[model samples]
Target: MTARKIIHIDMDAFYASVEQRDNPQLWGKPVIVAWRGNRSVVCAASYEARKFGVRSAMPAVRAGHLCPNAIFLPPDFPRYRAVSRQVREIFQHDTDLIEPLSLDEAYLDVTENKTGLPTATQVARTIREQIRS
Candidate 1:
């Protein structure tokens, strides 16, 4: 019998992270991905925005009220999806036993990995390094 090694990886604030990475102007600021309409809600909030109590599914208006300095941008599904695919590719370098839970999250079975990492934690470390570069 063999023990199973499972690893869960989540891209923090996926949309906002990609937005910040692409737009230098958004760096080091509160960023919220949401439509600019009265009825719109927040799709994702960067860590800076989260510090101000902003979060996913919250009313955009309220988010603005909570963080007046937050830069609000509409959700970019195509870009986000592309980034998700890239992340998946990174995961694939280590293991094929991946179950995607969301655009930003997945579960990986790393008992046996293509990368030959000693453990799931090492596999995760390599994946994170790849994603950052």
Candidate 2:
């Protein structure tokens, strides 16, 4: 069997990242993507929010209590999907052997890639540059 080069990309705090990307005011602040309700749960929490002990799957009310200044926003799947597609496009530019696990993560087999990159690390760097650009 041929060896495989698997790269796992973490679309870290995806929902919160998208929200921050779309709204400049959310930058450098605790951002939580979840509804504000007694029973609502956190869909995603930004790194800043995480510092305050907020995490995904946590109750919205508890998140608030943990970080009272945290900015809460409802989940936007459409925009997330669009951004996720853009990310996938970047990955596809390097390899086609991609297995999507979720909007926030994926496994990419880059043992033999279209870009002819020397290593999976290089491919990941290129993908990150493309995403940033």
Candidate 3:
């Protein structure tokens, strides 16, 4: 039996990454994307924000305390959905065996890919570059 090669792609911090990608002002700065309320949960935190112990599912208030300089932005589901579709399309170009877990994460089976890539790592790198572009 032929072994199937699988590649997992997960954006470091999806919503936050999207925000940072779109807004040059947020680059290299801690970003927390979520609603702001007395009782609000964090949807995503950028890598810079994570450095301050911020994380998803944590309360917005706590996240602020963790990273006082963290830029708080509301989640933009529409933009995120658009980016998700783009990533899905890129994966489909390489293989039909694709499973999406969320906007930022997916699994691609590249054992027999359309791209004819020699290794799963190379496929993953290509996908990452595509997503970034």
Give per-model CA RMSD.
0.9, 1.1, 1.0
- Model 1, TM vs. native: 0.96
For candidate 1, the per-residue lDDT at 19 reads 99
lDDT of 3 by residue, 13-115 (tens): 8899889999999999999998998799999999999999999999999999999998899989999999889879999999999989988888899999999
lDDT of 1 by residue, 12-67 (tens): 88999999999998999999999998999999999999999999999999999999
User: Which of 2 and 3 is the better model by lDDT?
Assistant: 2
TM-score of each: 0.96, 0.95, 0.95
In model 3, the runs with Cα more than 4 Å from the true position are none
Q: Which candidate leads the pack in TM-score?
A: 1
Query: What TM-score does candidate 2 get on C-alpha atoms?
Result: 0.95
CA lDDT of each candidate?
0.94, 0.92, 0.92
**Best first by TM-score, ranked:** 1, 3, 2
Question: Which candidate number maximizes lDDT?
Answer: 1
Looking at model 2, residue 12 earns an lDDT score of: 83
